[model samples]
Target: MIQIPSKIQKIIGNEKYIIDNVGMSGSSVYVFEDKVLKIQAAGSESENEYLMMKWLQGKLLIPEVLAYEKDDSKSYLLMSRISGAMACDDYYMKAPELLTDLLAKAIHMLWEVDISDCPSIINLDKKLEMARYNVEHDLVDMENVQPDTFGGDGFKNPKELLEWLIENRPEEDLVLSHGDLCLPNIFFMGKDVSGFIDLGKICIADRYQDIALCYRSLSNNFKGIYGRAACEGLDTDKFFEKLDVKPDWKKIRYYILLDELF
Candidate 1:
């Protein structure tokens, strides 16, 4: 059974809240009618999230931090909920043209953010360092990784993959990036982006950092990796088309493989 943290319980105080168990990892999230509570292990990213969300107050359609508290072990953040369904929800997924168009808009919107005073820097070196730490700590979930990333036909192990990433780093495009632009992290309301969630990794970094993950997410969602078949008219190539760029297969592959370490 899931346990609601005492801090969160006190904050909601006699109000009803629902614990979301699906797809949760390393953190616990509770949803009230008007607000959301996220509890996570106190870590560098936790601190990053608090500051980033607070900093992004009027810059974007994102959650507004109402309260935050950090103790020795856990950190809790309470924020307003963006009203909408997930972009990857069946209703949206079945409408590929709309989904693709909105995703394109989101990509462009992220690029438009002024990075002059961006608080976090998720450059390649920093990400590589994080990959190394996760590798060293055995924090990577190998089972959840791409099927071809391990076993007989793929890279032997995380160490080997890390070495490859180091040797083949791509040139940075330095833009404000979501760091993880997967569909579920995005919310949509009537063909417009409502907000972005999971801001811990938002930073100034290569644009492809967001692109690669987002593309993979699109493909996976269409391919039924999320447990449903591709909705009609789902065209994976439309992502790049909507973004107004040709696909850079090598860069995409590199970024996706690099994500395996985390």
Candidate 2:
């Protein structure tokens, strides 16, 4: 059976109950009466999340941290309840037509956030080094790592792919990137996106890093939502074209593979 932290239970105090497990990591996220209490697995991720929430307080649509604590066995964060409509799941099921515009707006919002004041957020070079380390240490599952949309045979050598990425990386735009931007991370009410969540990976990076992942996610999850014939009608081809670069499939695959371990 899963254990709820005593401190977290105490904080919620008599609030009517429900517990929804939201993430796959070691952290345990429980949604009780709309509020969330996340208990990080001992030494894993509590500090980074605490700091991210502190820096992101008023700037983004994120849960406010109410309390934080760490003991020898675990660390926990109590946060304000997030009450909103569903995410991309219901949105695509109900009104698939709006996916394009919603995604466009999400991209715009990601690009617009100011990172000038963010401290301790990892920069692109560091992120690249981390990725390189993962590749070098055989941490990535190369066999299963392939582009989801534009299907390609898995790369024979991750080091070769990493070298290519390092040699031809796009000039960095240094925008604030969601780092893990995908449909599930976005919350929507009607066609408008209400907010974004799962902010632990937020960082400053090249604009292409964000765009590449977004493009791959949309292509993978909702390929049939917008039929091929509607390419012109939906104006999606134009939107993707304006992203101004082809996704480096190997690098995107490498990053996705690395994400699975983290």
Candidate 3:
């Protein structure tokens, strides 16, 4: 049970905040009535998300950063919660067609943003270098990665996969990307996209960086990869149709494999 720093709580005002434990591993998040407080080990991506949220304010529907405090060993960020449930919630999952349509729209929305002065550079080289650092430092959590990433059928280890990625770089199709465009990170309001959360990796990069991860998210959520019951009549082809793009399996696989390192 992590406690919010007293000095920081004074700024946000004392309101008995209820804890909302959500999101993926690596950070502890507490949700108040109107805000979310995320705390992580110091020198993590909290600063990146805070700055990126500020930069994306006018461009997209995202959470507003209320306050940020960092010490030598921890980072705390308080932000306003975006309205609406996760796009992958049971209600949205039941309406697979509408959810697919909204997801396509979300991808297009990101592509349409102006990136002439974007601050984050999430190009392949930059991302691959980070992957390399993780591999060399033994930082990757091997147990929870995609089942296929390591085994008799797949590459021997992260180093082997990194080598393959370096040798097989694809031609760049530049677009603004929500670097972690998984299902939970996106929120929905009715039939439209409400906002996106967990924006630490938001940057200008290949469109497939987003498309690949999002495709994987949909497959897992609808096809029962994450332990929830699979939704019937939910085919990814409908997603590709809504997205107005042909499937590029090679690029999609490449990006997904790259993500395993992180």
Model 1 misses residue 50 by how many Å? 0.7
Better of 2 and 3 by TM-score: 3
Model 2 earns a TM-score of 0.76
Per-candidate TM equals 0.94, 0.76, 0.94
Please give the CA lDDT of all the candidate structures: 0.86, 0.63, 0.85
Which tens-of-lDDT digit does each residue in 43-142 have in candidate 1? 8888988998888889987899988987788898999998898889998888899999999998888988898998889899999999999998988898
lDDT-wise, the better of 1 and 2 is 1
lDDT of 2: 0.63
Predicted candidate 3 versus true structure: per-residue lDDT over 86-183, tens digit per residue: 98899989998999999999999999899898877778888898999999999887976888788789999999999999999998898888889999
Model 2: residues with Cα > 4 Å off, grouped in runs: 1-5, 14-26, 42-45, 72-74, 141-144, 147-153, 224-235, 238-262
After superposition, the stretches of candidate 3 with alpha carbons farther than 4 Å from their true spots are 1-7
Per-residue CA lDDT of candidate 2, range 1-262, in tens? 2455676667777776565554545567677776777776655246767787788787777778888887788777788776555444643534545776676677777777788877655665676687688777887664434444122554446665566556655455678777777666677766577777666677777666666666656655545432222221234465464544455566565455434323
67: Cα error in model 2, Å = 2.1
- Name the top lDDT candidate: 1
Clashing pairs in 3: 20-31
Would you list the rank order by TM-score, best first?
1, 3, 2
State how far residue 66 of model 1 sits from its true place (Å): 0.4
Q: Would you list the clashing residue pairs of candidate 1?
A: none
